[model samples]
Target: MATISEQNASSISPVIRLHRSDDVVIARSQLVGGTVLQEEGVTVSGLVPPGHKIAVRAIGQGQPVRRYGQIIGFASRPIAPGEHVHTHNLAMGEFQRDYAFCADAKPTRVADGNATFDGIVRPDGRVATRNYIGILTSVNCSATVARAIADRFRRDIHPEALGAYPNIDGVVALTHGVGCAVDAEGEALEILQRTLGGYVVHPNFAAVLVIGLGCETNQIARLVEKQHLEALVSTGRLSTYNIQETGGTVKSIERGVELVQGLLAKANDARREPVPASHLVVGLQCGGSDGYSGISANPALGAAVDLLVAHGGTAILSETPEIYGAEHLLTRRALNAQVAEKLVARIRWWEDYCARNHASLDNNPSAGNKAGGLTTILEKSLGAVAKGGTTNLVDVYEYAQPVHAKGFVFMDTPGYDPISATGQVAGGANLICFTTGRGSAYGCAPTPSLKIATNEALWQRQQDDMDLNCGPILAGTKTIEEVGAELFQLMLQVASGQRSRSEIHGYGQNEFVPWQIGAIT
Candidate 1:
C-alpha cells in the first residue's frame, strides 16, 4: 500500500492512484473521451465524471478489481484500459478473506499531555459537552405525550418558557417507533430497553423523564431495573410515568410538564468546567459518500481519530454492514485475539442476518451513494474503514451497548445513519463527526454533530450545513494531517459550547431512530 505522503503527491495529478497496484485511477474532474493521460499512456475512451473511476489497465472477465491495493470486486466482462469501472461492469463475487488476527497490531504512541475542553461535569464524575433535559418514550404510544412535555419548554414556541433558566440547553424528546408487539423475552425488547436506558442516564442530560404506555411490552419499570437505573430514580435524577397510570393522555402530558418544570432549577444549576479531552467520545460517521471520501474527509478524520486516541480520548467506528469487505483491516489492529474475534463474530452474525432476510450484505451503496460514485459495498467498505485511523482496535460491542473501553473501539450497527448514530450515542458518544460527499443533512440531540465535506464543490454548494472542508486535501493545497489538526482543534471548540451547523439549523429531534429487530407479533 502507498503511504499518505505518496498519495498526497498523486492528489495533485489529474487522476488519483491510491496505490500503485490499483487497477483504476479516480478522475479528479470530468474528462471527455479521447483525452490523453500522458503519464499512464492511456486515452480516455469515454467521459468520466469527477470522483468516478477510470480503468488504467485491461482486466479480463471474472478477474478481481483492485482499489486502495485491495480487492473491491470482480469484473463482469472484459474491461479495456481507460474505460469506466462501475456497477455495470463490476459485480460481487465470492472471495476468501484471511483474518490474520493481531498481525498488524502496534502499541499506540501516547501524547505528552492531555488536551482540555470546557465541559459540564456531573455529580457522578461523567463529563458532558451539552446540558439538556431529555424526555424519552418507552413505547411509540407515548411519543406524543413525551413530545408535548418537551414542547412546553421550547424557547422557539414560547420564548419566555425557559427565560429564567439560561444554563439548560433546550428540553428534547427522543421517541422511537417500537415497544409493543415484541416478545418480552426477545432480543428486540432487550435492545429497546438498553437504548432507552442509555439515554436516561446520558451525561449530556442533566435530568431525564421517561414516559410510557402502561400496557406496552416495554414496561418503564422493567427497563429501569434491567438497566440498573433504580439508583438514578431514587435520587430524582430520573423520572418515569405512564399514560394509563396517570389517568390518560391529557393528564399524562400535564403531569409530565409539571415534573419537568420542577426539575428545571436543579438542571440549570449544572455548570461547565475545564475537563480533559478523554471525556470526549466522538461517534465517527460517513454518509452520502463519493470516491473522494477516502482520499479527503475520511482519511483526514482518521488522522484526527489517531490524535484523539494519543490524547487518551475515545472514538467509535461503527456501521458493521458498511465495513463487510474491509473487516480484516481492523482485525489486524485488534488489541488481542479476543477483541479481534469479537468483531469477526459480529461480521458473521451480520452475514447470517442478511441471509435469513434474503438480502445481500452488498445491498449497500444506496442510490445516492452510487450517484456519488461508490461502486460496490467492497469498494465502499475500504473507504469507510479509513475513518478509524491507525489505532489498535480496543473493543467490540453490540448495537446500543454502552462502551466502557477507551481508545479506538467498534460497535455493531446498521449502515442507516440515524439508527447507527443512535447506537453510538447510546454507547456514550457526546459528539459526532460526520463526513459527506453528496451532502447529508443530519444531527443528534444532546450531542452536537459536526459535518465535514469531502470536496470543495459540496462545501461551497452547502456551506450552511458544513462545519469544515477537507476538500483542500483533494485540491492539493493541504495534507491529511494538516486538515486533521484543524479538525481536532475545531472539535475542542465545539465541545466547549460552540454550536455546530446542524445544531444551529435544528436538525436533531427527528433523527432519533433506534434499531428495531425481532418478530412484530
Candidate 2:
C-alpha cells in the first residue's frame, strides 16, 4: 500500500510514475512551464505533453531511463529534473534480457467451478458465442462471387424474416486478397491453408460455403486434402465450388446463395445454453497505444485475462513484433521448458523475417504512438505485453493455428493489429478485447470486440465507439483489480449477445488482412 503522501501525489500531482524505481513520471495532463511538483520537489522546466514522461530526478548522460521498473531507453544526453523525456533525448540501446525460462510458472488459484456463460452449443459439443452462415473464398478470383452471394442475403433478409431463424447471426463473406499470385507450396501456402481451414471449422459459423477459382494455384481440392477438410465435406456442413467448374461468375454466385440458404435453417437451429466459461477464448489486442496504456487499461485488461484463465478459459496474447522487447516476461511464465522454447523460437524467426525485409523490430511505435508519448519500441512493448495479465503460459501457436490448450498462450503474428486480430479470430478466439489510448475505430467480423479506453478523456471524446472506460484507474478512483472485475462481468455480457459499440457502428466489414509472406510470383 502507498503512504498518504504517495496517494495524494497520485491523486493531485501533475505527473504519474508507474514504479518507485522509475526515473520518469508521466504527465497526467499538459504541463506548462512554472508548474510545481510539490511531491517530488521539482518544477516544470518546459511544456510537457499529456502521456509524455518528465524527469522527476536529476540524471546524467548515457544512463538508462526506467519506466515500469524496466529500462525503456538510455538518455542521449544529460537530463535535468522536470525536463521532458522523449525521442529528442532518449534512445534505444542494446541490453541483455534475462530469459529465465519458466522461472515464474506457478499453480493458478482456480476460480469456482461453476462460472458459466450462455453459449450456442453445437451438436458436436463445441460452444460458440455467435452463430453465422459464412461464404469463404479460396482465391481472390472468387472474392467477387463470394461477396455477391453474401450481399444478396444481406439485402434480401429483413430483421422480421431473420426473427424466424432467431439463432442465426448473419451471413458474412470472409474474403481475402492473396489466395493466388504466390507460390503453390512452402511455408507461406501452408499458413494460408491453415488459416482458411481454421475458419471453416470454427464453431461460430454453423455452416460455410467455400468458393474457389479452378485454375488458381490455391486449388480447392489441394487445400481440402492438405488441410484435412474432408471431415466437413462428409458432414455436409461445408460445401465448395469452383468458378470455372460452375461455369463462371453468375452460376457460382447462384450456387453459393442456394448453399447458404440451405444452411440458414440448420444454423438457426442452435440455441444458447449454459456452458462453462472454459469455452471462452478471448484474443487480447492493444492499438494506438500511449504511455498510459500499460498504466491503466492494459493492466486492467490483464486482470480480466487472469480472471478468465482462473475460470478455465483461454486468452491469446499476440502481436509478436510489438512484444519484441518483452518476450522474456512471457518466457518466464511458460508452464514448461518446451512452451518457453517455442516462444523463443518464434522471436528468432521474427528477427530473421525482419532482417530479410531490411527492416527492424524497432520500426514500430508509429507516428500516433509517438504523439501519445511513446518513444521507443521497448517502451511500447512493455506496455503492450501487460494485456496478457499474469497467467502461466500454457502454449505457443503458429499464426492461425487452432488453440487447443486453455489458460494463457502466445500466437506468432505481426505487430499490425488487424492482421494479428485476424489470426487470433481464425484460430478460434470467439471474443476480442482491444485497448486503445489514441482511439482506433476497428473491429472484427464474426467476433465481438470490446474497445477499452485507456483514459477518461478519450472515452468521453469517443463515447460512441468506446465500450468501457478504464480512466478511473488513472484517476486513482479504482484499482486495477476492481476495474478488471468490472471488465470480466462486461465480457460475459458481450459474449451473451450484447452488441458492442463497434458492432453498432458497423466498423468491422473490411479489416481482415492476412499476413502475406514469401515472394509474389
Candidate 3:
C-alpha cells in the first residue's frame, strides 16, 4: 500500500492522498456536500464517511482504481471527481503480479541496538518473558479436568501454597476444541502433534502437564514419542496422565493438581535476567483492519519490525490467506531462491485449496472489513504486508513449527485471527503485536499481546483494550519512525515484566483456537 506524505500539506486537510499516481484520497474526517478540499481544488459532491475514499480525478468504467500506488480494484461504473469510491463503484478483478524472485533482496546490515530486557532464563539456555505452569489437554474430552485442576490454584484455593515461590505467573489450561474426531494420520494430525510439541517445549511454560482421554485417536503416548518428550519427563519438566487411566475426571483433576503443585515450586524458582534483543520473537498480526491500517498502525508496526530485525531479533508474519495478493512483495525480499520458492509453494497450495473448496481468494474482506473501507483481498493484503517492514525473508515454516532462524520469517496459518495467532505462539513467539481499526479484542497466554489502535477514535473508544495508538501518524502529530520507536521501547518494557492491556484484563485464556484441518470423521 502507498505511504501517504503529509509533509507539505496543511494540518487541516480534509483528505489524504497516498501517492501522486493514486486516483483517490481517503477522507480524513466526515465530509458534507460542498466542502472544499484545498489540496485537490475539488468540492465534495456528496457525503463521505471518514476513512472512505473520494475520487480525485474522473475514472472511466472498467478502469483501475489505484491506491497505495497499486490497483485496489477496477471501477465497475464511471466515477466522477468527489464521488465516494467503494464497493458500489469498485469490483474485484485479476491482475498479474511480477514475482521477480530475489530482485529486491539485500544483505541485512545488522544494527547494534544496545537493547536488553529482563527475561527468564531456562535450563536449556533459552530466554522467556513469562514463567507459567500449563495444563495442555490433548482432546476436548479431557478439557474439563485440565481446567478444573488449573482453576483451583487460579482462584487461590490454597493461597499460601505458592507463597514460597513468587515468580510463577499462574496455572493455565490450554484447552482446544479439537484433538479428537479427526484422522489419526496425515497433515491434520501432523499439525496437531507439532502444535502440542511446540507448547510442551515452549520456554514460557516452565513445566507442562499433558492431559488426555484414554481412547482418542490422538494418543498421548504416540504424541510424546513422536515429539521426543522423554527427556522432558525425565527432567520433571513434563508430566502426562490419561483421564480413564487415572480413574476418570475427579481423580484426574486431583492427580493433576498434585502434579502441578510440584511443578509450581520449580517454576517459581525461575528468574528474569538481562537478555539481548536477539532473544525476542515477535508475532505480527492484524485484525478488524480499516483504511488506516496501512496508513498508520501497520506501517508503524513495520517500522518497529525493521528496528527489531536490525537488533537481531525475530519477527513472524503469518496468515497466508491474508497475504495472498501481496506475496510477490515478500518474495522479492526472500533471502534466497529457496526461501522465495517455499513461500510461492504455500501460495499455490492455498489457491488449489480454495478451488477444491469451491471458493476464491477474493472471498475475504469480511463484513467489518468492507465497512471499514477495505474492498478486496488485494487491497487488504497490500495493507497487511506492511506489518513485515522491509526486511529479508529468512525462512518459512509450517504451522506450529519451531522458529530457529532470526530476522523476518513466515509461518503458514489461516486468516482467522485466533487460529493464526495460536500457530504463532506455538511456533515460539514470546510476544505478539496485534493491530486493529474496527477493534478486535484478542490475547494469548504465556506470550503477552500488545493491542495497537489504528486511529485516535478507536484508541479512545477501546481505552481498556488498546495498548498503543498509531493514530498520530495519520493525524500528523507524529511520524511513523517516532511511533515505531515508541512501540519498540514499549516492547522491551513489556518484555521486562510490564503487563500489557490484554494481560492486565486476562484476555488470553479463551483465545487459544488451534487451526483444525482435514475431515472430522
Each model's C-alpha lDDT?
0.91, 0.87, 0.89
Model 1 earns a TM-score of: 0.98
TM-score between model 2 and native: 0.97
Q: Per-residue lDDT of 1-521 in model 2, one digit per residue for the tens?
A: 11112344355767786778889888989999889988778898999999999998988899999988888999999999989899999999889998899999999979965677899888888888888888888888888898888877663454554666767878888888888778887777888888888888888889888899888888888988988889899998989989988999998888887887787787877888888888999999999999789888999999999999999999999999998888899999999999999999999998998899999998889999999999999999999899998889999999999999999999999888888998998899999999999998998888889999999899999989999998888878788888999999898888888889998876565777777888878
Worst 10 residues of 3 by lDDT: 1-10
Point out the worst 10-residue segment of candidate 2 by lDDT.
1-10
Candidate 3 CA-lDDT value: 0.89
- Candidate 3 lDDT over 294-406, as tens digits, reads 88899999989998999999999999999988899999999999999999999999999889988887898999988888888888999999999998999999899999999
* Candidate 2 wrongly placed segments (more than 4 Å): 1-9, 155-163
Tell me the deviation in Å of residue 409 in model 2.
0.6
Give per-residue lDDT, candidate 3, residue 313. Answer: 96
Estimate the TM-score of every prediction.
Answer: 0.98, 0.97, 0.98
Count of backbone collisions in candidate 1:
0
Which portions of model 1 miss their true places by more than 4 Å? 1-4, 10-12
Write out the backbone clash pairs for model 3: 2-68
